[model samples]
Target: MSYQVLARKWRPRKFAELVGQEHVVRALTNALDSGRMHHAYLFTGTRGVGKTTIARIFAKSLNCERGESADPCGECSVCTAVDAGRFVDLLEIDAASNTGVDDVREVIENAQYAPARGRFKVYLVDEVHMLSKPAFNALLKTLEEPPPHVKFLLATTDPQKLPVTVLSRCLRFNLKRLLPDQIAGQMRHILGAEHIEYEDAAIGELARAADGSLRDGLSLLDQAIAYGGGSLKADDVRAMLGSVERGQVFGVLDALAAGDGQALMAESTRIASFSPDFGSVLDDLAAALHRIQLIQLVPGYRPENHDGDDSALISLAERLAPEDVQLYYQIATTGRRDLSFAPDARTGFDMALLRMLAFRPSDGATPAASGGQRSAPSPQRSAPATPSAPAAAPVQQARPAPVPSHATPALATHAPAPAATPRVADAGGMPDWEALIQRADLRGPLGQLAQNSALRGREGNTLVLALQPTHMHLAVEPMVSQIADRLSEVMGEQIRLRFIGDSQGAAHTPAARAASARSAAQSAAEASIEGDPLVQALKREFGARVVPQSIKPFES
Candidate 1:
């Protein structure tokens, strides 16, 4: 009458009941149904991913009282006994504990004999890789040719440790780690069946924390239920797991987006007060940033992370520059790795936040919070982007708007509505490159490519362009074709493009013009900040000196 934990109680008694291991289930089911069972079967995967569970279920399927079938009748004596761990034929071995030649010899000797109470003698060896080299050699021949009545079900989390000789003898089935959605679904089923009140978000937290193990997920769920005093709450689960809510991570990002140093620190303090794992908080931050980046770069991207508030995520995707998100993600992930070397978790976490703030993209386009204490320059004039950066994401600017880079073609053009867009030829005789790009309404990578290119006049029907050496990489066949098609559409003639490396025309490229504009804007912003009465007062009172490199001109 002792209370059984959820993991044990919910342990899959039949193949159909098992979750997130369909491939294994299908093969075993087919084998059982077709009577094509192998003598030695090895199930390998990470812990709690159903390696041992599937082995047991396969054993049950083989020895079921009704018949040898995939669907074991749970009410049958043989099946019930197997489920209860009382089946005489089912010899469960802990290879970790009994990892000697003597133990393996015992197993070998037992294999010669038939099942005591069932059709087949099933030896379920858990953590089979833990067996010593001598033990593996001792049972090697026996494993390859076990008696007709015997079956070997070897399970291991680390299959790599197993001897190739033993591995080759057996039909190896590598089980996969369960996905978050799969684990979450099972948790929901369990909670609903128990009639326990639980938030869906709480289940998600538990599932993610479970880290692709159903048993672990269930164990966490049990603990969460107990901690929440019966009903599972998102706050309680997050508190128990030493993890922050997605909203808290977003709060941190919001503060960064606003350029509010005080708000960022306060958010960090609030998170630390939870006594949460700083590494996990950084993981969450990186994960959010990843999803944000995907949203920014991937057209019509739908997040699969199952966050309830994707609208907010999309808003943030628009709010933060793509490059800023990428930078934050990089810092967060690398910071998480170096957490152990940090003096403490909080300090590491704080330093990571500071790094994000400090390294906030220098392009003058990222957003700064109004009336906020921010030292980082607004990304207005983009930093000199190396051609190596992602095509769509230009690094610089802290404005909430999509800050155009040196290569941002005010006129490159697109697949969007072409009817409303202006024609490039409207500039008359010789096509104005700037007017062509603007009128062509180029956007995305194509726009950037056009922005980085300057029209070196036309060669008959083809427009000759001078492409920056750094940006020549972006001039792929498909992009060229798209630009050609766009130009052909905008100008009432079939236009072809011939790109030449920048020799003299690089100075006249749209990107060059943008760079000049940016330089002037940057100087103006620096002068404005330096000449400000408040900044001058701070300089005199606190001996505060502005870091020149940190200054980026604010772009509207």
Candidate 2:
């Protein structure tokens, strides 16, 4: 006999055997026990998540010779036949293949007949969403009003595609995907029952790789067992799943935390030697960073049962700050998707590594002096002049005096300055418009409008605001009442807000300003390179032009 895979060998025999679907199982069991069975049942969930499995179990319970109960006796002829897929009464159809109107019509015609050999004729249609619109329409009436002894069990991954007409006719039970812990627990149980030797780390890896699908997890385990011959190890499962070792991920993260450039490059090269997936390695790094963040936020939440390989991760987590963990996680997460755009996997991995290093916070130390510092003038600074033109003089500004240590406590104690008073023409005089908006706690577009709009002189029971055309467009008409109410609060009386567009001002467009700043900086850098001492020294030493290109911020 051919060897049966773990998925099929350990398939759930009854509702009790199902995992991660207690809610659905309980509802169905109560319905069966109370004799409140619906003629048609819809089971919806992702693949390998027990949609069809539950349907089969429900069918067996409905037609079990022992009577309707949550636990059907497998010894009964009806249950035995159904479990073996040989029951004439249980018609299993794959709607993916048979989705035509004619195929649906055939099923509807078959529904008119009596049960072949069981108490009820059960039609189990898998992937029912694959059926065409007209096909769904053709079976709607029959599915809603099936014969007393007929039961229809429809299963689909994408239930949204099913028409409301068909959906309304059946009782829907949505099976949730199995959680990682739940999948890991089930795997342990299966491994113990199969007398297979396995490590908890190996089971956890398989569970994560399965991504919340029990059948997929079992299939992965079956493959791992065959690969390992008998005893499953973390390395075997990692290799089979093409996942990077947790140690390598921790090494890269450690290098990142220490800000060790040479070590980072060396570790990356070693990782590339194994032909490990660069994307998955980055993903593992992100996951490690997230775990570190969790551990930092909530002490004693560390995975005490972690395998030996996780020691480096815990140490790295302790060494790195919480903010740095969050930053690296973000960079690695974003860089993983951008990896495909690189020239090669190595280059992609290198770029991702560089990105992490680039954003990594410094430990109050200057970077190495070997690599020349790359600096760009401030955006507010004017562009540089040519040789013939007079060089622009650097502007000097007075620096604020440092706060005295004795005054620091007083400064901290003082509240922020109150907003300016509004020029009011009411009997009470001017009101504080800034205080009103602050009191209202305005946010988003409304807050932006209140921040930008200037309070003009007010008329009787009216507050006038000098708003730009753009601000007026955002705050006028739509949110006028909300702004008025806030103003009313500040004025200590009811006031109307009128938005008068400012014709004297030119609105600054953010995009145009950014483009102008970039252009000016590029021109200034080109001019500055000729005057740079390092560029002159390089020209004299190596006869090189010392062209400034690919200037990146140095990581300290």
Candidate 3:
């Protein structure tokens, strides 16, 4: 006689009707069928995940007039009344409202009596965690050992607040949140049954917006149906949810992969026209990047229709390096975090996109001058500073040639030499391992690996190095190959390298020698400061203490 909301109209009446909680359903089904029922049962989960729904269904199963079974017959008066929320024997209490000890005592007082009409007098308490400590204590005795005709069904979103004493007495069943696919499938089923016209993408948007709550999803569906004039379309749903269109998001990513700043900005302008939530747009970008990474790493993996154009993603994957994708994803997530702190949403998002382009790795080339001379600084290496420049310029200038930031120490050590450069050997003959490593271009992990390694010996073209056990993780295949290549290049001959892990093998590596030198210099500096006559006079006259940390060794 009255209009019913989808949540109410499609409420699950039987255990078989429940979704995404097969584990809990199976346990309850087996227990009920075996007639090995616990007097007290507790169901815990987030809201709209069917905790209260399962409790009501369990109550119906206990009191169904056809029989006390897992599947209750809807035709029976007891099942009908329970479903209608008017069953006298099934007392459904909102513990959120009746949370006092006196209210719990009243329920306890009523539990002493037999069932009014059904086989078992069921007491279903929703949000039971809302009950006070005294009320929970009051529920303990009755909950533990209720009358043979009584059944207690307790539901709560938060079970951590429940006392262990009460929890131990009850059989607890935890309901899990439904996944997006599960929610979407359920919506498709419902829409089909209702004879509603809908786009699958529209359903996907609603499902994602639900954030793992099916009831929330259904409520959103009800709102969507109304908003879309009884028909669901992707654009309408996207607009309603303030979600970015899949095409728009992928377009931004495609532009990013191409390193086209103009195209990316154009796409940003298009995305802005939708008045979409920029944070959500950034989230979509991050998610798409993650999928691209997965696709790249696992070639066998397939993308779904909801993930946007597969061909485009594959193209982007091939165009962009894995490291670049990772960097972009990191920047996007970081920007999303700082979006609120920025002046505006668009500014934050634009900056994040610009950062992605700015940090994109260049191919180590400089645009040639009109006369065909390459005067611009090459992307491969930093230019040497002029002697006339200020003091600060030399610090950056004198640093090692630029290499991929993500390059391992081994890679840094063996960076590619200029094509026109001629092979050079050590001034005299084969230098010692320490001297070779010092001349090696090795940077991060590669440098550390070399500095920690000692050349054991050489056999034919093969070089044997002892690697410390602590740094054995750095002795991977790429690092080993790079070291060998770099060594061969510098020695003006091909060479093979091998590493043996030894705990006490290398204590005199270049890194160790450098550390020893720094320590000696620091000690000398401290002694020099302590012995200074001006320092002694200040300490004696004014009791001015020398700050040990302030002493500098002036390392060469």
> TM-score, each model?
0.66, 0.63, 0.64
Q: Which stretches of candidate 1 lie over 4 Å from their true place?
A: 304-307, 360-377, 380-556
Candidate 2's C-alpha runs over 4 A off are 298-300, 308-314, 360-556
- lDDT sort, best first: 1, 3, 2
Q: Candidate 1 on 374-488: residue-level lDDT in tens?
A: 6443555223222122334323332244555622312111112334444455445668777678777788998998998988878899898998777777888999999989888
Cα lDDT computed for each candidate against the true fold: 0.78, 0.69, 0.75
Pairs that collide in candidate 3 are 409-445, 409-446, 410-446, 413-442
lDDT of 3 by residue, 1-556 (tens): 7758999889899999998899988988898899998898888888899876787798889889888889999878888888888889888878888866576767766788888898898888888888766666667878767789988888888999888987898889888889989999999999999999999899988998898899999999999999999999988999998898765777777666555667778989999999988998898899889887876566467677674466666555554566567767877887898899989999999988877766432321111112321233233433323312222312223334325552211100112233343333345443577656655677787788888887776778887888788777788988889888888877778988888887666777777877876766666566555644346457866999989887776533
Residue 84 displacement (Å), model 2: 0.9
**RMSD after Cα superposition, model 3:** 17.9
Q: Compose the digit string of candidate 2's lDDT tens values, residues 1-556.
A: 8988888777787999888889999998998899998888888888889876786787788889888888999889888887777888887878788866576657655787888777788888889888666666656867767789888888989999888988898889887889878899989998899789998889878988898899999999988999999889998888888786676777676566555667678889888877777888888888778887776566456554545644455455455656557667866876787788989877988877866665422211121223322232112222212212332322122211222331111101112234355333345565545555666777777777776676675788876777677656776666788877866775578978777887443233222334555555554444344433345447766898744574322221
Residue 389, candidate 3: C-alpha displacement in angstroms: 48
Error of 2 at 252 (Å): 1.6
Ranking by TM-score: 1, 3, 2
